[model samples]
Target: MSQHIALLGSTGSIGTQVLDVVRHWPGRFTIAALGAGKNLERLAQQTGEFHPRCIAIQQESDLPALRELLNVHAPAFSGEILVGKAGLNAIAESSVSALVIVGLVGLAGLEPTLKALYAGKRVLTANKETFVTGGHLVQPYLDRVIPIDSEHAAIHQCLKNEPVKAVKHILLTASGGPFRTFSAADMQKVTLSQALKHPNWVMGHKITIDSATMMNKGLEVIEAHWLFGVSYDQIQVVVHPESMIHSGVEFVDGSILLQMGAPDMRGPIQYAMTYPERLPNPEPKVHLDFLSLSRLNLEPPDLERFPCIRLAYEAGRLGSGATAVLNGADEMAVQLFLEEQIDYCAIPKLLEAALNAHRQESTPSAPSLSDIHALDDWARRFVREQANPLTARSTG
Candidate 1:
């Protein structure tokens, strides 16, 4: 009785690590389907190995090229091919997979997540943007939605068999990224390569940038609010450069329970894939001698230095539409920065302007899917429209 898994974003950092986990356990899990972006070569390789019953591509124009690669690489792949957003939804709604892993980045993961939950499939989500944007829509399905982010996964483990009411606060640990010691003046001149050099983990470029700005932590804050049924005030961000303590829960009785592990995405991926069942690590990387450890410094996140976190908190508190705008703005701003169109500091400024615009516009408290998408579109456009002015101000 193998558990079938439908993995979206099959070629991403998280998706590849998930495959590593599945590869370790022979018959425990199976890849029933795969949904990938534009990496046909890697997708074909995965299809050849995993032999999923169905596969999806982000663009229809890539289908012929994908088929040619599959013909040469995965000649045995007879799986039904699907294309575009419809294909992603088809994968989510497919009857073969019992669990769906939403590994796709940004707003792309939200609809498929909803489809999977509505189709009675348990969803293990690594995409924080889903919750940040559509927390209200996904609230009723919280039991079916599992968090794959390291911080949320750690807090989920700590709260097991524990009363939610008794929990006082959630202390999510951050690596403080590569810019922890960087002053405001230093950050103004931060290069693209410098921002991508995350201190602890290797992740996708978007997330790596978010980490550098501490915006990833901000997104996690909103995500934790939805996943754990907690308020913004109850969640605190602690800058722990070591990343040893994944996250912690403080109880009302003055006791704190923490889940500590090596800096690895596979740890949480494996845990979510096989919940309530802890298995032996296939390959242990770091062995810790707790008594001989020298230093584990923990401090508060600097709101002034990393204002993205502040923007995230304000957005989360504002409501659904604002969070959607924040996420959309961040995505566009990150892209602009990566392309050298905007400096690193302009990222947060764009986000702030988008949030302000969203505040001025009339927004629904509980927006529908269509409404979320509309808000996302507006935010991206707003950021693009404002990027030039922000960039000039930052550089001039």
Candidate 2:
């Protein structure tokens, strides 16, 4: 049975890899809809190739050109759909698709993800912000949420067939970014280019910076708590300089299960897209022989050096709007760091302030999608107003 897919953020790194997976297993999947943020050329090429029923672009200004391009080949193509409120609904509610891949980065991906889940579409998710900001809104609808991130995918695979209660702990591994060896005092002088140079992964600018500051691990910790019904304490972050061991699960019987592979996004992406069944693809193979699989090292994350990871665990424990604040604040902080509006070390300080300001709403009913949006907006504004250079201190 071919799975029909609605791929939101079709122009992104993860989104493009998803298309690669589909292309490899042509008979196994179909693209029902495609959406992207302002990358009209790539979006147009995807639309032409996939012949999806609907396509969405972020900017309304790009619509006219996209529509004309589409009309030249796909004559029935109307104006390019804008992916605001309605486009999100359209992709989720599209009758043709069985699964929606929500790969949009940052908090922007949250609403569309909820819409897809609530509309009964299985979601292959790569965006950490979706769960970080609004898991409460989407948890009730999680019968179909599949993880596409490698670490989460590893956990998912390890936990299969095992009772959730039988799991003793989850070990979420990190590559420790480019600055794994840098002391806390040295991080203050780090440049943007230095931070962007990730040691193990090729990712977008925002995520690369997040990984450098260990904020990516922080976000993953939040993602782990939601994906697995585990407490914050049950989830552990270990810095594995080599990215080979994606993640691990320790059972109650003291047996540890680990998933190891080359650091490739397609492995997990393909798994989520063609789930419950495996398909063959000629992507790069994980060769343990020539690669020298000699040693695998694990160390406790240096929370003093990487406060963002600590802040994430704190927010995870608090629940409520805490994750929303952490996610929203970090998003803005990362943007600021990238723009040189703030120094490299200030990212977590800003996130910490936002988390402190957040007041947990009482055993609140499942948050509405709009409620999450509002909190995200509030966090961004709060960080911008309160973040200061002096507060940015060395992690040590």
TM per prediction: 0.97, 0.92
* Candidate 2: tens digits of C-alpha lDDT, residues 1-396: 777899988999899999998898877789888888877878887887888888887766776887877766566555336566578667777786878998889988887887777777789899998888887777777668989989999999999868779988999999998988998889889999999899888988888999999999999998888888888889989899988889989999999999888888989998887678776543856443535777888888888988989998888888747788788888889988888888988888888878877854443434566676777778888777766534433211
Which pairs clash inside model 2? none
Per-candidate total of colliding backbone pairs: 0, 0
Write down the lDDT of every candidate, Cα atoms only.
0.91, 0.83
Model 1 residue 391 distance off true place after TM-score fit, in angstroms: 13
lDDT of 1 by residue, 1-396 (tens): 899999999999999999999999999899999999999999999999999999999999998999999998899988799998999999999998979998899899999999999998899999999999898889999988879999999999999868679889999899999999998999899999999899899999999999998999999999999999889999999999999889999999999999888888888998998898988775676544577658898999999999999999999889988898899899989988899988999898889889987898899978899999899888877888787766645654
What's the distance in Å from true for residue 257, model 2? 0.2
lDDT winner: 1
Model 2 alpha-carbon drift over 4 Å, by segment: 68-80, 285-291, 359-366, 388-396
